[model samples]
Target: MTLPDTPEQTPLTADTVLRYHLCWKHRDLDGVMALYHPDIQYHDFFQNRVLGFDELRDYVRASLPHAAGEDIVHSDRIRVDGCTAFIQYQVTVQGGDGLVAFQSSEAITVKDGLIWRINEYATLVRRNAKGSDRSSPRPATSRLGLSPRQLSTMAQDLEHYFQRQRPYLDPELDLQQVAEASGYSRNQISYLLNQVLGQSFYRYVNQARLQHLLASLDDSCTRMPVDDLAFAAGFNSLSAFYKCFREHTGLSPKAYVKQISLRART
Candidate 1:
């Protein structure tokens, strides 16, 4: 919480942290690996795991953003003391009721101009549609070998799989199927959907199905009955389709189709 009143190693610590930050920002795995001290220790409190130098290479690589411009907001405050620096940041995943993110902080101890120790912490925050935020002190799921960034990436990967493969178009689709298809374990996928993104796996799949039907509705969808379209989009039952439709569009299927027709006429 507090640093030295007058720090001597502030400049050296600042330089080391800055380089480390830049290496991460640029996604240079080699550069990041080069900065780690041979005896470095990384403590990830969220995962309840500690990784040493030998393990950090793969861990850091897994934790880096896979896609460019992913939402990682670093704070302006990078505090430094004799040989330690504290940094704060947030990694946001673009889904859920509103915005779901992890408020993450790190304490870095530099030794001999290299990163010798790191203590990392993360808390999950979920913001509802009404603009209120609910946060968990630490994630309910632990020791999963996933960082918050990895969870974010997994969410994106799941979305992409749905978009490209249209896996939700199968009426009998299940979580195990998705897990296998997406190359993630069933538990990992479940946690990302339920805890991080704040929704059930079926709810997420139904949302994809609804989106598929909505796209069809936007383009000459009147010829086919909405119920038929719902079935085509993978809803095995009418009741489920109607609920998903109403929750997403705030209207029954018939009303939505009628509104689309009216827009076409106008």
Candidate 2:
């Protein structure tokens, strides 16, 4: 007796399947979403089947935020027909509290240039020896893993960069420039800001400028007007300066100055 082939055997074209995989790997939710029909249905290893556009949209929004690094090893494709395709791939994710190493399998189904469904099966693989096993543990590098000399160098570079570049005025100040100037990679900069500094890039730059502004305010010899002082402090706009100033100092710039003036008189 001869056994029949499995229903999971689906034929897919190379071009269509490669495009789907590219979109997924790039984390382009919009591109991936566009590949799905309005009435698409999808199922994952979680035993949940998402149906319709709204449900899929919400699911993607909620899940994408948790997605981190991707290390995919192999991806292959087959076309069942002109309208249907399947792709199989192995992916590794950083696990541990600091995102270490976890491996998984992903299967994507595309129909008529849209993703009809996706099935992913992920399993915990290994933990980093230096990283925490907690869900949201900071990276080991942030815990002073570097030598004392290296730490001192990094701190000195960070301070000097802030003083020299004055990145606050440039809204486009990004990790690449900072890393290059500090002799670090973009990943190193990101790790420094996220893990060591415990702040986002925008917040870190703004806080540094805000501190400088506060110091300047304490010196009466500087005769620049309040608005001019704000701009000179690297704030691009008066409104943004006032907003961040209030947030950092718990008082408007004018109010803070008045309080300082009154205190000095007393």
Question: Which prediction has the highest lDDT against the true structure?
Answer: 1
| Candidate 1 lDDT trough over 10 residues, lowest sum | 1-10
The digit string of per-residue lDDT tens for model 2 on 134-162 reads: 23242443322232112323544676678
lDDT of each: 0.87, 0.56
Question: How well does candidate 1 score on lDDT at residue 122?
Answer: 89
Candidate 2: worst-modelled 10 consecutive residues by lDDT:
93-102
> Model 1 off-target regions past 4 Å?
1-6
What are the clashing pairs of model 1? none
Separately for all candidates shown, the number of backbone clashes (residues 3 or more apart, or on different chains) is 0, 12
Cα displacement (angstroms), candidate 2, residue 55, comes to: 50
